[model samples]
Target chain A: MTDQASGSIHSFYVHTLGTPGTESLFWLCATLAVFGLGMRLQIRLGRAPWANPVLFSIILIAAALFVTETPYATYFQSVHIINFLLGPATVALAIPLADSIRLVTKSLPTMTLALLAGSVTSVVSGIALVLLFGGSHEVALSMAPKAVTTPIAIAITSQIGGSPALTAAFAILGGIIAAMIGETTLRRLGITDWRAHGLAAGIAGSGIAAAQVAQRDPVGAAFAALGIGLNGLVTAILVPVILHFLPG
Target chain B: MPEAFFTLLVFQLIGTAAQAALNLPVPGPVIGMFLLAALLIWRKSRASRREAHSPLSPDSEPGTSAASPALAALSRTLIACLGLLFVPAGVGIITELPVLSANALPIAVALFGSTILGLMVTALVMHRATTGGAAPEKLPDTGGQVL
Candidate 1:
């Protein structure tokens, strides 16, 4: 009798799994579950600089899709609701940007100079290095905006005819690298000002690197926040103009 | 929260319309960001001016009072989970495995090298500008506290 009941339960499971609209629901749940697990893991790990929840979630979900022989198009369709939220989230960034304006205006001249220098360097150096290494123009274009926050980076990437997916990956990876090396590099260069440290992290690493600085220095975090907003605006305006002059 | 969300969407819609009509290269949401920030800044300044003129009013934090509570809460919640919103796009990397694998070396070099280079350049420029020209003067350590 127990064996018979178990057999019926297994059949029920298979039936539900094979349903039409249920498939999207299943994948959506799976996406959230994986992301939740990743966040838990990140927290459990004490929010290590390299323990990026987004990176973790992407790897697990991508692996699951690959292992299940599911195409990316289908997976994306299932999770499109979450993707739709990105636009509003991007707009929400203005709140913090406005909040920090007073602090930012204090060092306007110096900060503006540093911001311009960092923004130009990030785009030019990434594109130049990619081309120097014989990478394709498409890849170089995607690499161009890897230094800003993910939403802005993705928007800029699409605007510039680059692969948004590749740009997302590059931005996250760049953030991780910057978080890992940023503090030590700043110290080695004999830079001790927290504001400068924050600017460096925010410019090169975006939010992830800035979070690291946030833990140790609140002032730096504020500057880092300013850095993220200002850099996003500057890079968005700068890239197309730069590409317009470049020979195809 | 729902109303706040709708407000954000409205701004984004306006931004999209502006972008298309103006033939701007920047994205719609970014323009929305700028617009929203400008609105908040303007409100804050106006409120501060009113408070300055009125002697009966107690000093209140202008930033908090100017931005609506619901909008502030929504923005905070959204920004906090900002990382999660990008997972879908990042997972699309699965489809570009071929390009990524083929140019793995170059991609790695460009990403890491450029990030480090950008960091160094920004930090040096900021340090130089703040500390004055010639030699770097070690400022008194504020123990990570904002002056």
Candidate 2:
């Protein structure tokens, strides 16, 4: 791209969103618009909640990058404090678990088996596709934990020489996409159980779907809660073990 | 804020202990959770003693276990943190824009590919649990729509 043309595009992006809108309540507006668009599309199609929130958000962010003319650095600066909350948000999951520990103890075998399948296949397929498509080892590593919950996914990505930032994107995308398709895929395959449903969604979809499960079927909340932690633990341990065999 | 801060510090210390001492595989949050679970379990086991001095013992059972003020405060603080958790990930992307651009294909491949695969595995596991587990359960009904 020519410098003059690039400069003009940059100028256009800044002018389009209008600088004043990037501050104060505008981000909230943009956030709502982005989520509303995705939700509207989902409802229009009668789709499930997990249908790739990341995809829509990414598209919006990309558009914002150009149309708002605010540099990525500036946006990150504005949002960094909020972003750092991921750490504590994760710890907060402990609440539900502590509340339901006895229930989890009762269903340990089932939950563990479910998580085993989830954590293993998530990483294996992630690595396989990444290689099949000729993705680099770094990319593969970053994606290795996409199926795991966010906090552990970030840790695994960094440990295995993958970019954690990339991992975060992949993890969010994984949760959104999985939450979208989890229910449909279960039925097509003939799997049906509220507990299993919540567990699968929780393990695969993370907190987002888990929350939905709590609303719809409080009984299944226990299993879903266990699933979240199980998948995170299983992935954390297995991803590293598996990474040693991968190219990276 | 200080109450929340102290809760945060306690969790941070517990997380570090679990990770460093026990070689836990998951991150600080998971370790912290384990600690929290342990505490809850201990409190439950010691309900009799705790209630003697405490207000919410079996004898003083308020409708719910309305957690101690500190614990309740901690939960509130954690919920508040959820809104901004994705910021760090966004920051990481911005800081490494050059690298992200240099290898957009690989990143995209890894992301989209894993998502599709992860979705499949997730559903499969759900299926297994439904059929294999003896626990009577309801099949989630959403018409098998792959969103």
lDDT of 2 by residue, B32-79 (tens): 766665676677657656667866545634223324566655654554
**Which residue pairs in candidate 1 have backbone atoms (N, alpha carbon, C) closer than 3 angstroms, thus clashing?**
none
A1-248 in candidate 2: lDDT tens per residue?
56687778778656654356655345545654675576567567655555544355556765666554566666655555555555565555555555556556766666667678766777887778777777777777787777677767777777878887777766665565555666666666665555566677667667655544543443455566667777887787787788667663
Full-model lDDT for every candidate: 0.79, 0.61
lDDT of 1 by residue, A5-61 (tens): 656654664478525667678778888888778768877987654676777878998
Worst 10 residues of 1 chain A by lDDT: A9-18
Best candidate (score: lDDT): 1
Identify the leading candidate in terms of DockQ: 1
Q: Each model: TM-score of chain B?
A: 0.82, 0.61
